[model samples]
Target: MDRSAEFGRWKAQSLSKADLSRKGSVDEDAVEVVELLNSREEFFTTSSCAGRILLLDGSTEGSGVQKQHCCWLLVTHKPCARDDVMAALKGATSEAVLKFEPFILHVQCRTLQDAQTLHSVAIDSGFRNSGITVGKRGKTMLAVRSTHGLEVPLTHKGKLMVTEEYIEFLLTIANQKMEENKRRIGRFYNYLQHALKRETISNSHSKIKERNNPLCTHKNRRSQGKAQGPSTTEDNGRELEDGDGLEISAALFLGDD
Candidate 1:
């Protein structure tokens, strides 16, 4: 099937399927972004997580432990309370680890351009680890993610490996990551809305301008902005950088996957 047809079929079937994530449905923090993307004709979300602070076991034994094999001692999308986490840790049968996983989203785009556009929004919004993967089956997926995650072993073989003071210290870091994750998600959603609207408005404006004045050319349009160009992008030749004010290398490809 053609890419568009394939994407359409996949989207329809996927959206109709039951929520398969561990939490059953989309997290409250991620619902808006997922709905926003699904509302767009060019994109649909496959899966998403708002971000979470996790306490799990069975993962400390292996280098790449699958989540399914691990026992989720505790999982919270919001900042975890010390008492709640301490209570959850009591059920730990083996090693227990505390972790903070940042927000992640998987979006299927109708075209490569759509994926790239979404990728830019993610990168600019501080999900620096975001990436695009084009499958052999003509599926273009963009994963919005970041590397600001934390994992620390709190217990070993059902025995406390660290002092309560240390656990509290760890929670402080994890909670900070959770707060930062919230900020990034907010930025991503806000920027994505603006970007999509800008694209549509720019396209419509170009068509209307051409239809209204067929003789108007690119040079004519360029001269029209010359008077107020100081505040426009035309004067920010060297000021443009990554959204986070970091020096983004031109050669940097937005992919860590």
Candidate 2:
């Protein structure tokens, strides 16, 4: 199987899947970063979210939080306003929790090397949870994530646990987290762009070296052909002229048959 061609096919399919999602990220900067990654040849976005602030009602179970029965009172990809959050809290029936999740992005890469490079960039940009994983079809994928998140209980059994002042305080912190997420996304974009530019430069230099070295160029091949004498071709039970137009392994007979 052709790995490069297979990667191209997978990338096309993933891009189509991304387009099918009608919900766009509210964070314009995050959207811009997604577009930048998609524009590169070695990477494609599989799934992405700019991050969000959520008001949810959930209860604790034995060891884990029972979020299956949780209901979302409010959700916004951007920072939530004090009034908007307060309004959502007024009608809470159960324990309500406020959450601030950082930006998360899943990228399908063409090679393990590309995946590794992206993983490193994500980590360096403060996305500590960033890592690489093999996909179902043996493709390498990178998960970009951060450790910056907030989950605080706001109310218990329909009763406000804290005053409005406390809620406002949490909102301020959530907004700060949102700004940090944006900055990380921006840093990731810059680093990835630099890496791409370096790759392009390295490739260009290699091509120039090959042409100048006279060992891998067309001129070199012609010289080798001359040193080895004219090529030969064979037909069905017949010996053809050396100049006959025939492909003998990798050798090319340059004239008409």
TM-score per candidate: 0.78, 0.76
- TM value for model 2: 0.76
lDDT of each residue in 76-195, candidate 1, tens digit only: 998877888889989987888888999999999998767766877787677888888999877899999898999788888888788778888888888988888888888788878866
Per-residue error (Å), model 1, residue 63: 5.5
| Candidate 2 structure quality by residue, lDDT tens digits, 2-95 | 8888888888876665344446432565777788888888888888888889999866544655435778899888878899999999879888
Worst 10 residues of 2 by lDDT: 248-257
Model 1, which residues run further than 4 Å from truth? Answer: 62-68, 206-257
